[model samples]
Target: MKILFHVLVSSILLVSCGSSKQLNENKNSLTKEINKIYQENVFNGFAVSIVDEKGTLYQQGYGFADISTKKEYTNNTIQNIASVSKTLVGVALQKAQELGKINLDDPIEKYLDFNVSNPNFPNEKITIRQLSNHTSSIVDNEFYLSKNYYLKSNQDLTNVKLNFDEEQVFNPSDMKISLQKFLKNTLEKNGKWNKDSFSKNAPGTIYEYSNIGTTLAAYIVEKATGETFQNFTKKNILQPLKMDQSGWTFQDVDFSKFSKLYESPTTLLPFYEMVTYPDGGFITSVNDLSKFLSELIKGYNGNGKILSKESYKEYFHPQLSATNFIERNTQNPYNESYNVGNFIGYGYTGFIGHTGGDPGVLSMMFFDPKTNIGRIMILNTNFSNKKGNDAFYGIWNILEKYQDKLIK
Candidate 1:
């Protein structure tokens, strides 16, 4: 193992010469495969970064960041990372633990002013770990706060789908004023689905992938430290790690460097106005996100910029049963991803990542704790049910096909 204590001392990166030739060959192969995929698919733009414990091995971008001005997308072009932000929240809580603010295994109610409990399982108290791993048994409608809710059975790991009427759409403006405020309403007593939202299944037993579960976790961090999630993450994770190109809001980023989003190759999508910001509101660049990913790789190797080595292991540990991850879940596809090996494989981690998708976005961020290697990818366009071998999730498949080849 190439354990470098010097990385702990400074952010100055080291590159090993062992696989220089193969690394170049892998890069060439990846570029060709990626080009072929993007050429055949209708994508506005995409950015990707690959890294190990030492530093970034490859970072690149394709297509146009701003089609109006014909600006070519590059590594610094920022985009809203969608649900991948959950991992950021997970890491923040780890920092909160280091600061003696909260414990992952402790009941989440202890951190909040409001009582958070599943009414069906009233006596059961949810823990921070469950929330992080999506086994909290708190079902999320991710839209309306009432009705359409179900309990997570230990047997189900896929995200639960509710029977919402086609016309019964939701508006972000109608939700809570802030993410913290939203959690208070959604997870507390007398709240919209206070009773219905809580599952009969006990907390820490079932794996129901939830955006609300993670948003609540972020709120717990805020309650424990008396600070907003954005400010806390900026102060502790982003700034400390020197991910200067990343932020939780518009004010933290350079508008000129931002990539315009799209619903399709030619269709446009507005920038995000987040009601549940903590769940999917992080905006960052391949360069900045690479720095964060690099630190995580370092953390798994027992050396990190912000989170301790132990925290890294704990945060990335699998939260579901082996069978739950042996086959990928289509419903909660954002929280985990697998290689294109007939069956999707988590390769030792189902919680280390949070893939993202919306009108015009398809993104992924994942790392293997054992090998200290990971990837961050974002696309400004969303393609569905395309007809080909590498149609929709080509980026993931590409990385999976060459993961070992690219990792030095």
Candidate 2:
């Protein structure tokens, strides 16, 4: 009997050792595969995170944050996350609803002093839900593109002639202030700021993506919280998640530590201030973002600590359906169908996330709801083509190739 008991114990010990070795080998192989993908893609910098239903399985950063200085990309190396910031804003808006600070169904006019005018639109009342879902038909703020408009219109004229002789003028630093002023001025000057213009669509009729919709969200958050948008986010979302490196603006950042924006061929691009920080402006590192994703996967914290499970569910639920397919030939090739401030299931594995590009940056963040897997890619190069098709498709293909390792 004693001999038999000893034999059983020895067998159990051998099996345990074998299992440990297998686990280590699997982890090493996964890392090797990820590195291989990075090398093959020539991705300047990227951070990937894989989280299971329970928690994070892998979190790693690859390539250089600044190639010129040879600064290796660390988990803390901040990059402008672009429209992924919208997801964060959406969550905050939902939180406000939970707290009874605001109602999603409330008309935006109740919270704003400025009037939105568009006679062609059907809706007079624009709700928070519509804005969050990008169903709000508010005129796309033309002021946002005034500089682009002036530059394109006066392409033949010298800079001095364009600015001095032309009736319209633009200053990059004052762009945001100018945009707000222009909108206000145009509305007043044209007598178009009333219900006809202010309330264009009937809340939820058409699906037109609007940066103004998100800017309204930021404005509402500020009004409801009695705090600046940045402070409220920091106090509520960032602090709770322990995402120490994220911020809404440069003033809130450590300028020296921030990664210098770069373009292809390693040219540094001028840092233009994002007029609408709520829409596509916050910056963060992959390490902190991984933490954010992990929390989101667990339904805003494993135990519903930050946002209740119901709130999270509501946030991720598809709010709009494609009445029809829309096609565009842009720098990136995509047949994207939008539903409520998100790009749903574009690439392989039907990963849900947003992609953003402006000037010298391109970014993507996708997280699978069923599998709790997530991937993010941020590139400094603009990949300029008449149509920006290559930039989007290229990144999508790269993500698809790694789907097995990332998702499963």
Candidate 3:
């Protein structure tokens, strides 16, 4: 009996060692495959992370964070992750609800100090749920591009060529104003900076992506929780998850670690900020985002810590139906506009996460519910042409191919 037990233990140990060896070998193979694609040079600097509910399976960065300085991008390199930042707003809303501060069904006007009714349907009440699902009928107008962006206070605009065609205009840094003032002016009835900010449809009747509407929802969180949006999120989301390297504004992070954004492999963009930051501005490293994604996976699995499991369920619940979209994106498997839950999005092919693009930035973060595995990509350069698009998806596809092997 003693001899049999010894043999059994030895067999288990041998199998375990073999499996570990195979996993490490697979990781190396994944790195080599990804590195090959990186040679295409479609983006200046980018980071990719693969994570499971337990933790990160793999995280890496490639290329130059600063080409002139010869600074290599690493997992700790930080950049603003455009609209992917909206997911944190969703999480923040759920946390506030868990604390009994607000309800999703409440009319947004209840907590607002200013009026914001659709000009076409003044009496139709817009609910918080509508904003979360992109059914509020609030549209980002031309002013959204023309007025929201401002250059960093320190940037010297001596030789920076503003791309008007792309609506990449950066106002002088001193013109940067408060979020409330910006939203109130853009969203209020006949307020300054207001244009065609509302669609013809009634509130909660159609899908219209509204960055202003999202910022308004974040403002509502401030009113209900009696906290600044930045502080509230830092305390409830960042602190709880230990995302020390992420922040809503420039002041909260180590600016030295921030990556310089690119218009092309050779053209650099001046640092800038948006007045309606809640809509897209989130500064973070791939390492920090990997931690956040892992928590989201855990939340989906009903073992999360930041918010109750019930809140997580609500956070992931699909809120839009077929009628909500006039034309749903069926071809693009990664299109987040197909559906929305809270502030996060559901892709056409059932991926849950969000995608964001801004001046010199592109970001995508999604997780498969069935597999409980997630992937994230953040690029410092913009991609509009087919070659860049293909290369972007190429890295994502390679990660997908290897995620299963790394899943333990």
Q: Which candidate is the best by lDDT?
A: 3
Q: Which 10 successive residues of model 3 have the least lDDT summed?
A: 156-165
Clashing pairs in 3: none
lDDT of each prediction vs. the true structure? 0.69, 0.60, 0.90
Q: What is the lDDT for 320 in model 1?
A: 61
Cα deviation of 302, candidate 1, in Å: 1.0
Q: Compare candidates 2 and 3 on lDDT and give the better one.
A: 3
C-alpha displacement of 195 in model 3, angstroms? 0.9
Put down candidate 2 lDDT per residue, 1-408, tens digits, no spaces. 999999999999999888777666665666676576556534566566555445555566677776667787766777676667777887789788888888888887677667653545434666788777766665454445443222222122321222311432434453345334444554432533222223444557766666666767777877787788888888879999888888877667664555545444345554545556677777887677777766766773335457888787777677655552243222222322444432122332344666666545567666666656666666555555533344345444554455454332
CA lDDT, candidate 2, residue 8: 98
How many clashes in each structure? 1, 15, 0
Candidate order by TM-score, highest to lowest? 3, 1, 2
Off by over 4 Å in 2: 1-42, 121-123, 139-142, 146-203, 300-303, 324-336, 341-350, 385-408
lDDT of 3 by residue, 47-104 (tens): 9999998899999999989888889999999999999999999999999889999999
Off by over 4 Å in 3: 1-6, 156-159, 164-166
**How far out, in Å, is residue 381 in model 2?**
2.8
- What's the TM-score of each model vs. the native? 0.79, 0.77, 0.97
Candidate 3: residue 331 Cα off by (Å): 0.9
